[model samples]
Target: MVNVGLGHAELSSTHSNGRVQEERRNEGVVTSWCIAKPSTDDESLNHNIDYSCRQKGVDCRPIQPGGSCFNPDSIISHASFAMNLFYKSAGKNYWNCHFNGTGLIVTQNPSWGTCKYPA
Candidate 1:
């Protein structure tokens, strides 16, 4: 199921047995990740990556070739990973995730396959 609000959307899935399973965004947990807004262009994302990766404690190794988070190989994916690392390393502040208004703080886990995004 998908719930589309004014400026946000929520998604859920159903198992083969026909049971609806909602996304794990609730349950009294407060986890956040910094991701590039979908409307952000590649040039902006690249700029974000450059800025975030240069910060101290922002380890961008996982997005390098042969790294766990390297499979997607998309500017958005890499930018999101790098941005999140910078955000997490910078104390998870709202401003830390703000990459010139191109970043967004999301509660959903963007992890895919073996690439686990840090919370």
Candidate 2:
């Protein structure tokens, strides 16, 4: 079991190979989120949003006006959402979260109210 603060998730596994030989693998899912670093400047954050939003699979609609995450509309808020979406969609990897060194991977969810950061 993994305690992710949000809740506990049971670890799963899989078996492979034929009856003659077998292999087992634990398919544990780790939840994580990416967001703009607190120290990142407005310019950098905006750049991250621009770059991330342009990428495929990154839905920037949530950050648009009248969108669920549009309130509290600020560079930091919007950038965090866009960067996280890009990181999640691009493949949750260390490099994916490295938005010119302005991105951070956090175990704690950055979600709030209707703003849900994907994991």
Candidate 3:
């Protein structure tokens, strides 16, 4: 299961309606961190972003964790800016973006050393 944002919100598998389903709940204030691992293709980027948004309880479409298109250089830069803003507003470290394999990964509560950005 992926921990999206604050609230204990998780995407868990459920067995209902004769098929497996995804259940979402507002648990309140995401405490655990989340990671998005994408494949090495642009087509998968959208799925990755969707996964992240679902995990975070946010409206992130056309982009889900493990998807490809989600790794735009401009998007990464913008994400950094948003992370900085979140840190400043909340007075707590929040989001981070990094390149791994042929894709990008977004993580929370990530170690500073894990960042691939230039110093």
The C-alpha stretches of model 2 lying farther than 4 A from their native spots are: 1-27
Per-residue lDDT over 35-56 for candidate 1, one digit per residue giving the tens place of the 0 to 100 score: 8887888899999999999999
Lowest lDDT 10-residue stretch of candidate 1: 2-11
Give Cα distance to truth, residue 85, candidate 3, Å: 16
Clash pairs detected, candidate 2? none
Per-residue alpha-carbon lDDT of candidate 3 for residues 47-67, written as tens digits (9 for 90 to 100): 433333444324332223432
What is candidate 2's lDDT per residue for 34-90, written digit by digit as tens?
777767888898899899999999999998999977855777778888988998898
Could you estimate the TM-score for every candidate?
0.77, 0.75, 0.22
| Winning model by TM-score | 1
In model 1, state the lDDT of residue 66. Answer: 98
What C-alpha lDDT do the candidate models reach, one value each?
0.74, 0.70, 0.30
Cα lDDT of candidate 2 equals 0.70
Error of model 1, residue 2, in angstroms = 9.3
Off by over 4 Å in 1: 1-29
**Span of ten consecutive residues with least summed lDDT in model 2:** 3-12
